[model samples]
Target: MSSIDPMWRLTCVYGELRTENRQRMWNTIVDLKNRSNLPWLVVGHFNEVLWQHEHMSETKRPEPQIRVFRDTLESCGLVDLGFTGVPFTFNNNQSGRKNVRVRLDKAVAIDSWRDLFAETEIKHLTTPCSDHSPIGLTLIKETSQPTVRKVRHYEIVWEKAPELEEIIANTWASLEHNGDLASKFYQQKLEDMSRDYFKDLFAADPNITPDEIVDLFETKVTNMMNEQLCAEFSDNEIADTLF
Candidate 1:
């Protein structure tokens, strides 16, 4: 179980139960199902394969255990999300041997809890640390829209312009005095200043070459020691500084 916040308990169990304990364990799970309304996910190495195809080798299938587990899940209104990637989760330790692995790590969720989560992803993560490859399950919360980070783009066209340095120095000084500007404000100001500066310079000389424009801006910005400005500015500061 993993938790990003301290308010909730995310529990996980690995039940390597014998045949006799299966019934008791199932009953206990059912009891737990009735007791909690919070979001809960129960998954791990159950040591029980649900289907014949889950195994890589064609050995005899444990019909009784599979049937019992499936029946219990159905009765409890739980869904087997089935396998996400590789059908099997475990491989026998016999190296280079023709042993088969079966899907042991399973994921199950209640019907009522389905819409609560944005997505449930299950996959096998490489386990160089152990013999068994670890199964990773992730529950992602849904967001209505994609999160966007603010980025400032600047164009400078002035050739050997001393005034450009002063402008940058003044902006930097203002930002330093403000301690930190809001993200939107910083982005807007930075973009506005950059556009205005370039517009004025280009308007003065429409025949300016691209390389000359770049060189002029580079010279002016370097004079202001703006190389580390990107690192110093936060999201908002960057936005404002560019404008």
Candidate 2:
């Protein structure tokens, strides 16, 4: 395979329903991987889950099953492609609390495949026809130039400093004059101020005491502690934890 393109060894799996047979099948797959160091992907129903979170309600998830499934993957050096779209890929479709939901199906690939296809994306689409959801595996081709996404950043230390708030407010006011984006404005100011302040703080006189450190934080930070910790946390995480 060229540096621009990698090879594919797509192995479709439909693990046996029986425990003993499933173990044998898992061993066989492990053996295949051991023999070939090629970049490969395994997509299908594995009849098992590696974590309790993979199954909703947790009524049917036993420790032994999860243990064995994890062991098999560890031995084979295989991992889930970190799917998007859905938490669980398999559902019984039963209504009420009696319904069962588990991630029985997924696309797992070797570490080399991940390294080769850094832009690979696996999405678990809505389940149709059968209980299992159809998974889409995409390998993004090397483009003329990679798309650099806009990154939003906030400093954890700034949340405790009010100076950060002043910098933001002033930068935001300046944005009206410059007609620049909020993200760009914030990042630029933060990067500049953070470097200057931290460098000076570190270059302080040797006679500086612990109390002076707190004093420096107060002067430089600007009481940004009021920014609300919720702003730093994700909406889902805030809802789950706070509410």
Candidate 3:
């Protein structure tokens, strides 16, 4: 292999179906750890779950089974690399209460392997044909440029609102500052505004009650829209609404 190219010991496993047989596989992993010093990555359908949350079924996984798996990982010094996209990797494809889902497929690595590719990303892809979802891994190069910051684009409709200037002036006036402000403060405020988009837009003086805030919006929007604007939304709800 080229000197600049990354290299590691990759082991793909399809664990034994029986609980007793799986224990043998775990022992083999411990033996491998003792023999090899190379950065190691192990991935595949383990046929087991580490936590209750990883499984979704009417019947809970046995505590002893989880404990044994945890002990094996601890002995091997292997840590799970969490996945994105689908929450579960296996599905029974059944309906109603009979249905079951589990995160059985996974990727794990030793500490040195994790440090070697610190920007690794794991994802669980949709499985159309099989019962198990395929796990994918992305190893980001250390020399790669950092991700570009997302630019917050203002809605043209916001500029059309007559109250925009007054809202900005009120917010700036509320800040307690004397001389020139540092650039870091401006940068931080920009980030905050991007994160709390709607919350900051409708924010009022801290001294004003929620009722007073509603009264202020009475002139701007109808009762129904104002109600929605005042209503608290969860992060997921906001993402769903915006996207």
Best by lDDT: 3
In candidate 2, position 212 carries an lDDT of 36
- Model 2 lDDT tens row, 1-243: 578765667789998888767778778788888777788888888988888888896386788868988888888878878888878888888854567888888788888877877888888876335787877888885568757887655544555556887987888787775655876778887888767667766575777566633543434323465556435778898699987
Residue range with the least summed lDDT across 10 consecutive positions in model 3: 178-187
| Candidate 3 lDDT score relative to the true structure | 0.80
How many Å off is the CA of 169 in candidate 1? 44
CA lDDT scores, all candidates in order? 0.65, 0.76, 0.80
Q: What's the best-to-worst order under TM-score?
A: 3, 2, 1
Cα-based lDDT at residue 33, candidate 1: 76
1-243: candidate 3 lDDT, tens digit per residue: 689966789888998999878889888888888888889998998989989989999889998988898889888889999989878999999865678999998899999899998999999987446788888899884586777986655553454556557655654665544235533354455455555556666767687556633544437668999988899998999899999
Model 1 lDDT-worst window of ten: 151-160
Candidate 2 structure lDDT? 0.76
Give a tens-digit lDDT track for model 1, residues 19-125: 77877777877887778776666777777767777766646667788888778777777777654665677777452235678777777777555556538777776
Candidate 3 clashes between residue pairs 3 or more apart in a chain or in different chains = none
Number of the predicted model whose TM-score against the real structure is largest:
3
Order the candidate numbers by lDDT, best to worst.
Answer: 3, 2, 1
Candidate 2 lDDT at 4 equals 72
